[model samples]
Target: MVKKLHKEGSLEPQIEDMINRINELQQAKKKSSEEMVEAQALWESLHRELDSLNGEKVHLEEVLSKKQEALGILQLHCQRKEGGAQRKNVLQECTEQISVHNCQVTESCRQRKLGVQVEEQLENLMSQHKDLWELHMLKQRLTWEIRALQSSKEQLLTEEKLARDKLLEVERRLRSPPEVGGARMVNDGRRRWRYSRGRRLPQTVAPQRTRPAKERPAPSAPAPAARTWSRPQTHRTRPAPSPTPLLRRRPEIKARISDRPPPPASVCSPIPNCFTNRS
Candidate 1:
C-alpha cells in the first residue's frame, strides 16, 4: 500500500508539471496570434503604398509627354515666324530697289527733255546767225553795185564834156569870118583851111542836093513807066475780074475799122500847133 501512495504522489507532480506547460503553451498561442495579425496589417499597408506609388509614376509619365508635345509646337511656331520675317525683309529690299530705279528713270527723262530744248535753242541761234551773215553779204554786194554805178556816171560825164568842147570849137570856127586882103590873105594862105566855103561847099552841099535830086529823078521815071504799064494792064484785068477785087475794097475795110471802139479820152488830148501859121 505504501508503494501505491508513492507512485500516486509521483503521478501528481507529473500532472502538475503538465498543467503548467499547457498553460504556458496557451499563452504562447495567444501571443503568436497577435503577432500574425500585426504582420498581416503591415503587409496590407505596404501593398497600399506600392499601388499609390505606381499611380504617381503613371501621372508623372503623362505630364512629361504633354511637356514634350508643347515644346515641339513652340519650336514649329518659331520657325514659321522666322520664315515670314525673312520674306518680308526680302520684299522690303525689292521695293526700295524699285523706287530707286524709278527715280533714275525720271531723272533721265528730265535730262533728255532739257537736252532737246537746248538743242532746239542752239539750232535757232545758228539759223539766226546764218541769216545775219547772208544779210551782211547782201549789204556788201549792194555797196559794190553803188560804187560801180558811181564810176559809170563819172565816165559818162567825162565823155559828155569832151563832146561839148569839140562842138563848141567847131561852132567857134564856123561863126568866125575870114579877114580880107593884105596880111590876113598872106597869113591865111600859110594856114590850113579846115572849112573854106568855096572848098567844102562842093564836097558837103553839092553832094547832099545832088543825091536827093538824082534819087528823085530815078523814082519819078520808074513811077511814070509803071503807071503807064499798070493802067493798060489794070484795064485788061478789070474786064476779066470776077468778084475778087470787089471783095477786097478799101471802103469796106475803112467801114469795118470805123465800127471798132474809139481811142481812150486820156490818150486823145488835143494840142495846139504853135508852128502853124494860123494867125
Candidate 2:
C-alpha cells in the first residue's frame, strides 16, 4: 500500500488506501495473537508430555535397580549353597542354582504384585491431584470475579448516593421561592452587593427615599455599547478597525500519467496565511 501510494502521488487515493492498510494491519495483529495463543497451548502440551516421560523414566530406573539388587541376592544364595566345595561340573552348579531360584520365585512374584498395586494407587492419587488443582484454579477465578463485582457494586452505590444528593438539592430548590437579582448582604456585613445576570455590582448604603408616582426625573441618554453584550469595560475608548488579511487557496491538480518526472515537493506550514503576500 505504501509503495502504491508513493507511485500514485495523490492524496485522495492514499486516504482510502491508508485506511484499508490500517484495517489490514489490525486484522493481521489479531490473527498473529490467535496463532501465538495456539502455539502457547502446543508448548504447554509438549511440556506436560515431557514431564510424564521423565516420571516414567525415573520409575523404570527404580525398577531396574530393584531387579539388579534381587539378582545380587540370588548370586549370594548360590555361593552359600556351594559352601567352599570344589565343584568341577558346570551342569551340576546350574541345576542347583535353578532349584534355589524356584524356591524364592514365590516371594519375588508376591513383591512384584505389591509393586503393581502401589503403581495403581499412585495413578489414582495423581488423578485426584489433577482434579484438586482444577478446582483450586476455579476457586481463584471465582474469587477474582467476585472482587470485581464487589468493586462495581461499591461504585454503583457511590454513584447512587451522589445522584440522591443531587435529587435532594433539586427538590429543595423547587420547593423554595425563586430569588430575583437584587441587593444581597455580604459575608463581611459592612457593604451591600447585587448580582445582575450573574455579574456582581456594588450597591450604595443610602437611606431609602420615596418619590411621588406622577413625578418623572429627567436624565441624560444612555451611551451605546461597542459590542452586543453590555459588559463593563476597563476603558471608554473604542478599538479602531484593522484591514482583514487575504489568503489565496491552492489550486487542485488531477492525477495524470506523464513520462516526465514529478516536481520536487515544497515546504508546507500549518500557520494560517504564512505564504500569503503581506501587501
Candidate 3:
C-alpha cells in the first residue's frame, strides 16, 4: 500500500503539470485574440481619419474657388462705381453753373419788364442774351460730354464682360480634376520631397516603343565575339592608311502625267501631275 501511494503521488504531480500547461496555452490564445481585435480597431480608426481628411480637402478646394470668383466680381464692381462717381461730379458742377446763369437771366427780365431806364434795360437785355448764348453753348458741350461718358461706359461694360469670361475660364480650370491637367497624385510625405526637389513632373508620357514579333531577332542566338588585332612585334613601322570617304547616291526623279488635258492659260498655272494617267 505504501508503494501504491508513492506511484499515486508521482501521477498526481504529472497530471497537475499537464493541466498547468493547458491553462497557459488557453491564456496565450485569449491574449492573441485580444491583440487582433485591438489591431483591427486601430486600422479602422486610421481609415476613418483618411476619409475625413479627403473630405476636408475637397471642401477647402471648393471654398477657395468661390473666394477667387467673388474677388474678381468685386473688383469689377468697384471699378464701375469709381467711373460713375467721376461722371456724377462732372454733372453736379454743370448743374451748379446752369443754376447761376438762370438766376442772372431772371433778374434781367424782371428789371426790363418794370420799365426803368430804357438804355439800362437794353444793356441788361444784351447781357442776358449773351448769357443765353453761353448757356446754349454749355448745353451743347454737356450733351457731347454725356455722349462720351456713355461711350466710355459701354466700353467698360465690354471690358467687364471679357474679364468675367476670363475669370470663368480660370474657375473652370480650378474646378477640373487635377489628373486632367497631368498633375500627379502625391502622398503627404512625398509632397515634401517633391517641393524640396523643385522639379516639375513630365506632362505627358511618350508612347512605348515596341518591336513586332516578326521584326524582333531571336534572343537565343549567341552574340558575336569582339574582334582583336595583333600588333607588330617590331618597332614603329609604316603608318596606317586613311579611311576612304563615303559617297551617297542621289535619288532619281520621275515625271508624272495627268489623265485630263490642262485648261487654257490663265494668270496662274495648273498644278502639276495632280491625277494619275491610266491610259
Best candidate, lDDT: 1
Looking at candidate 2, what is the lDDT of residue 256? 13
User: Which clashing pairs does model 1 show?
Assistant: none
- Residue-by-residue lDDT tens digits, candidate 1, 47-75: 88888888888888898889889888888
lDDT by residue for model 3 (113-170), tens: 6656777788899988877766665665455545644654464456456645755674
Candidate 3's error at 175, in angstroms?
Answer: 99
Q: TM-score of each candidate?
A: 0.37, 0.26, 0.27
Lowest-scoring 10 consecutive residues by lDDT in candidate 3?
244-253
lDDT of each: 0.54, 0.53, 0.52
Q: What is the lDDT of candidate 2?
A: 0.53
- Each prediction's RMSD over C-alphas, in Å, is 22.7, 62.7, 67.0
User: Candidate 2: lDDT of 231?
Assistant: 36
The count of backbone overlaps in candidate 3 is 0
Number of the top TM-score candidate: 1
Against the true structure, candidate 3 reaches a TM-score of 0.27
Name the candidate, 1 or 2, with the larger lDDT value.
Answer: 1
Displacement of residue 252 (Cα, Å) in model 3 is: 99
